[model samples]
Target: MAVTGGRAPNQTDSDGRSELGKALRACRGAFIGVGIMSFMINLLYLNGSLFMLEVYDRVLPSRSVPTLVGLVVLAGGLYVAQGLLELIRSRILVRVGTSLDEALGGRIFESVIRLPLIAGGGGDGLQPLRDLDSVRSFLSGMGPSALFDLPWLPLYLAICFAFHTLLGLAALIGAVILIVITVLTEVLARNPLHEAMGLTVRRNALAAASRRNAEVVVAMGMTGHHTRHWSAVNDDYLAQSRRSSDLIGGLGTAAKVARMMLQSAMLGIGAYLVIHQEATGGIIIAGSILSARALAPVDLAIAHWKSFTAARQSWQRLNKLLMILPRQREVIQLQAPSRQVLVETISLVPPGSQRVVVAEMTFALEAGHGLGIVGPSGSGKSSLARALVGVWQPVRGKVRLDGAALDQWQPDSLGRHIGYLPQDVELFAGSIGQNICRFDPEADSQDIIAAAREAGVHELIVAMANGYDTQIGEGGHILSAGQAQRIALARALYGQPFLIVLDEPNSNLDAEGDEALTRAIRSARERGAVVVVIAHRPVAIEGVDLLLVMKDGRAQTFGPKETILGQILRPPPGPIKIAADGGVAKP
Candidate 1:
């Protein structure tokens, strides 16, 4: 069986538009408007050179003040029009970028959250978000405007050619040189820029890791060691960035210098033709302006080549990610499950892995009953918990709630009926009340307080300075581990879910916390909810009636809790006993 949110059935969609293309297509009108404006802006650009040519060729010879004044007014009007159109065009482009972001931001974030589950937590988690940022920045920046102006280069060159063949030839040569420089900039900067992008991801990951574990590092005197390692990665990233910058900067400078020299050459050629009586003095200045205008797009393109590359790369990565974890289609909502939780010979593999961690595990728990899963580390207890909560999918069988496969229900609807507290208790950066209600804006205050009471955290929360209004720091760092676990327990119990799976819920808890956890499980059971607790500690199972012991991804024992415990704790003739940590002990 395929994992949920894994590769789509059709990896390649030959007929469908890419997600990015679809987003852009939605804003096709804005892009078309930008194109029209670009055309008008380029057409108005001729006003300047033509005004100079007319003044030099006609007005200057006749010494006509009226003609000169008329030219100035006409040219100024066109310039103003051009500037207005350009401003509008730039604003439209920014809006287009914003629109695209609005359309795809939610989808991309959902993909980001699903990616780790599908890919087994490999690679950088924040990379997709970064890619989206790159794409948005490129679309909103001058890079796109420069690209739009490129088409006008040929028209400007044609005008230069119409002036005189020699002037045309000079302009043509300069354009060719700049185009070559642009190509070289792309070719040379590509690898270094790509390397730098990778280095940036690595550097960011390193810094995030260091910060996430700063307490451990500082307390253990490992800060210097991590710092040195960070320095090495930082140096590599900086070196690649510098190399790319230098290369692009050097080429951009070369393009600028070449365009200037070419403009001057066009003037020199125009002057030579004028002396030979083949062209007028006006042609010299006009040809230089036209040629410069023609090459300006190429220069701008060269300058923005780095951003273009980055945007292109980001687009490719986002495309691949979307393909791997395509948007989930709307599924029919299944009724809330309340009868029983069934694990029917289901085998599970970690996301992005072929190794089965929970193999052919079969067990069933009816409503109002509790099951405690006990096993040593790496025995797949946590994996089973994940599967039960639908965070993972089985490779061999199914997990059904009240006779309906979990996948048959829409994710959010199913989530509403289920509660899961993972081994690592994580809370968002919000007030405790918000976190308890799962950020549901319509959550009732009475229900929130009831959940806290059920989790035995209401008194603890009331004792806090801000009570439910207290803001938990990132990852709930503001609260101690025991406090976070109790709050998390409250979150799980918020809606009186049909199923509750707790993985090592008491690992960070003290005796009082353990009592609170036991009470919460009993309260859930009293409500006819299926409660499954994964724990290595014996005290955690004190309230559970049933037990499932796991070993090497397989169930080794399953029975009433007392029967299983008696079998486990019975003397085996030798001096060995069961240790508290689920290991063998010598007496």
Candidate 2:
């Protein structure tokens, strides 16, 4: 099975857990503090019921202004304290959310960067980040407060029972009915909400892809087709959303109606007790207020049920992603590889794919050697280059650098020693100087200029209006294709990495750029760096002394460049004509 399906290498043996759970656990103290505040707030809520009771029973019969004022003053103070505690609890919860984000933001971003490498570039590529946002937003909302207030419902119910048993029984019945509605809402809304979430992800992915390829769609007159496709996806997403909303909304309205009916029933029961000489008239008003307060949390929870469900699903998805791509373990620091790059019978499959693109092929390149890989389209030259540069892992064999496996060193550490310029070069949104130095804050100006000169693009950069400080738009849109390729070459040559791999380095280059690329390759080999170039163009292989020819995912030839090229250029024992596209034909 492909790893993109979420079956990680250590799925069975490793414990399935996420840093999110750990981060939440770290905020246990804040949650406990919030719970304590909720308890106090609930205790203070009785002030309203008790004050009504005193005004109706004590102050009315006695008609004492002083007693009324005293009760009013005490209740007012308690209400202020309750409000303060509530504010503090809200702030604490917000800080807890912030703290959790701060703790996991870096780790989450690292996972996002590596996700494509492990799972292939599919989907929106922002799902994990969105999940974190959902979790944080839910934490910083009223949902958590409602959850915390739920435990105090029994206290209010017990107080109502102290006033009259009949009123307590009525409140209990109403609570039971509301609880059932809450459970039903959860069960019925789950599937619709889940489907809505999936539709949302798909819709967003489509929108993102369309925006990225707008130029293509417009140039090819495909705008209408893409718009209709997006519309269909949007319709499905909206339908799911409307279904979830209607379900939650209908249940929430029912909950509100049931709550009001229960309050009225409490009043009726209290009035009956008063008529039967079992309670005072004050009990009627007091019981109604108490019952409403008792069920308020459940009602609030139901109102925010959608948010709760979204947060729960987001948490689950994030947890699963983290489990699949756990934190990279700390490896022993190894010396910088210096001697040779050994490709020992490696077989490679693309990420998120089951088809092997490169079969078991083996080769070795010693220091001070430059090897060029030549192959037809779909011949796996690029895949082999990916394996050589540690971008793709071999399933069956090892890629060793000076006898140490690629995994022996940390990724960042290993990256510093390998320079790679892919066929399709993309520069970041930064200045030319920053791009060349790999955004190193402490990068020396001399080193940056040296790399540029080595790639033979220093004069072109200096001739620009901003010299090296010119901002390259996202994906280097500001530069021409040839200019971008040369800058990418400079970036690869930066810091003089020991192993350099360039795939189709001259695909977009002019004669000057091609000469610069060849010079850069020769310079790297002179510095004892092992260089590998994968190319289909003839000029790209001129600087290399060794050659490897690939065909049908297998190495068909490998040896000194002259020997391999001589055999390929030699004529067969058949009459043939050289085609205009540089191919021999038997006609």
Candidate 3:
């Protein structure tokens, strides 16, 4: 009922018991400290009560009223202190929980960062996992309650046993019974619950797919009907949820029965011991009061085992995720023995297609010289640009930077040296200046403003009331697409790479914005950067550099623009012509 119906991937296992173990140890110390301090307060109250009684019964036989007044003060003071210690214990444990979350959640992010390639989902998995409430749910649902409870349980049992070994033994037996009930409930319930979660992922995926094609859904009037199709997924999610609930209900009832037995036994046995010679009325009172303190943690542990299990599963999944090797043939090692870059034969693969969208493609742009790539839509301009930026591996050719294969470049140093702008731009929520600098802490304000001015966004920034400090909403939604793109360009230029690859840098820009981009590219070139722009329009680069026209993944013409315009008019694959008016009617 998962796939053919509705379900998604449900990976499992944990990093280890070590994380849980460490959390438990810290909680045990905290809870123990609370318990110890509370025990002292309780003991002192008990001792003081007995002392008051001795004074009333013997030393102050005629002043029993004064003795009673002294006992009330002692009891009230210690009671308040005990409550305070409990609060302190909880506060201490919350801090530990927060710190432990750093370990648990931090490791998940570390795994994500180390990966060179992400499969299938593009790493959106971090969104749900990184959320603070989700982390809280994960932490509360799994970590502290289990660790803190399990150890405190035995301490509870020992305390109960002190009142009377028989009563203590009875409570211990009940605890064991509750634990068995909980684990057994889990064994029977886990599989179906996992099934429900799988269905939830499918529902989310279907909803995502539906939203992606909203125009199609609306044009076809398929929204309402397709929405029903989507509801089928939700229906399955609910059904699975019911199955999970029923199984858990069965386990919960069993555990409840065991808990009731323990509660009833603690009362019955304490009462029996008090009536017999084994325990006193005060011992019975203490037993009733302390039973909750001891049993609370144990029950908590059982309740959250699924969460602990899931956190463990998340840890293992992330670790395996990080270990994935990139399928790209070029490794980008940056360590190969090579000096100046002079390419021989170069080839590149296009996105989502085999057939080497670029074939036998070769070019050499010297250190100070610049190269600009211009082509029609499917002519592999972006593919060539990606190869330069080391984003993709050439299927059958080589890309060398400074005479070494591009794969040998160390990623950090390579990125620091090579700036790239992919067609799709992404920005985080931050101030305009921060977005321009891309959160480079070391970037001087003057440098950021300078880059912004060069990218033609300085005037735009100044127009806003907050100027550079204006908040750009998430993904820079506060700005127009062209504005966002220019800011992204500014970020790339600010990096000052030796090579800059711009793919459709003007795709979303207006005519004026396009002019700004053209100026930025020329400026980058003037600054001694080897600029390779995958252009859709005429070259605004000042110099007459060479031009390459591609047809069916092969360069059909390679020469200077002044030398090749006629061939471009009647280019191989025939001339890309327009009919009627001028707007690219057809090829």
Candidate 4:
């Protein structure tokens, strides 16, 4: 099954287990080929013991130089073939890993972008990529090889038994001991390893947060405090990691010692059989080699147990995240919006809070109209703006555009006709033109220039060292705050969006910038666009035709701009009286 941006229409699995299963299934042929090569490699492995047996039993007794030369050549050829097969198997595994990464990386990234900002509290948004890397590393590493070689253990043990029953019994007992050691490693390391993983995730998040706020850290002389805080988290991570390592290390050492003892014991048993004339010296050598081969995979597994467990945990977490945030399916293509926005009794509560941030907001704007939202600092102006543009879903009621729910339209399709400038403006690292054009590969130069002109930033952009091609550093740090805000405004105005929502767009603008913004709003309205502006200062909303007054999460008044402004600035008829219940009363 092909992985896409959204959940597949026919996908019925709730947990997304089937998606992972499908990725593995795509690589089934490669794995099967690797399995076959492993079989050949194991068969060739026995040639060493067989060569020793023949040399001691036949060549030595016969003293035929030609026979010895012939046996050496045959064994040499088999060894070369085994090495070639091993190389091919490794290559196949590497291809499988890359292919799996290619298939899921894009899909996971798309899902991460679509995730609601509130839902992604304290997450760096790159965790999914890291999880994908963990899975790929496991697939191409020594862990899977050890697992593949495990099934051949019985075959090696059967060969040991063929040599002599006592040798076979010794090998079996040694294998059992190693298996027990493996179990012990898991039981002892499980909790500590789990704790270490959680600590690592938190540490990464802290580091990312600190980096993003480096300016504040330096300005407030918080560098020392941040360092100490990070160090504490790092120390905890190290402690748990050390605990896990100590247990695994002790068990690994024990397994090594036991394997060595098993080899010695096999030699002793072989010597005893030879003395009784029950077996030849050749069988003694062959039995020791076969017994060691039988236990090799078990030892390797014990050595790499930590990585195996980490990969398993990462897989489970990734699956759960994908299940919870499945991709959206393709929707029927709809025409561009016609600048009609309807918000019906929409209320919004923050992701983890019970208090309503936006309460029962009901409004409508037709083509060629502008609405200004004025409110106090905590009166939910920003929240209402976010809901209008579909950033935050309303807990109750709906936001409709062109007679359809906002969410009913595919996100990309809906986004094309909706322009939004958030309270905090940010620009990615790229050329100025790219940022203004929304990073569209097929963006038209004429349209980009038009947008910059519309936002009154075209002259500022052209004055830069490279004009429209000037490269903005990370988060547009190369430009001033005002410059960045203007560029973001230009981005929102690009493509002549049918509906535009600006949340405190002029927060960083100077007097001249303010004039440019007013002109831009007027121009949009002239072009039949429905514009919504959230502002604190009255001057910023001078050109708006309608006004919405918000206070304490409720609409205080809504009407033409002149009527609401008059009411707000006008005094009450008589002295306001205080009621017994501490409420204001008009008599």
Winner on lDDT (1 vs 3): 1
lDDT tens readout by residue for model 2, 74-191: 9999999999999999999899889988988877788898888888988879998998898899999999999999888888889888998888889889889889999999999999
Quantify all predictions' global Cα lDDT against the true fold.
0.90, 0.89, 0.64, 0.88
Show model 2 residue runs off by greater than 4 Å.
1-17, 574-587
TM-score of each: 0.95, 0.94, 0.71, 0.94
- Give the Cα-based TM-score of candidate 4 against the true structure: 0.94
Worst 10 residues of 1 by lDDT: 1-10
Q: lDDT per residue, candidate 4, 522-567, as tens digits?
A: 9999999999999997778977899999998889999999998899
lDDT of 1 by residue, 146-221 (tens): 8899998889888988888888888889988998998899888999999999999888888888897889999999
| Residue 515, model 4: Cα distance from true site in angstroms | 0.9
On TM-score, the stronger of 1 and 3 is 1
Q: Which stretches of candidate 4 lie over 4 Å from their true place?
A: 1-6, 9-17, 116-118, 574-587
* Model 3: number of backbone collisions: 9
TM-score of 3: 0.71
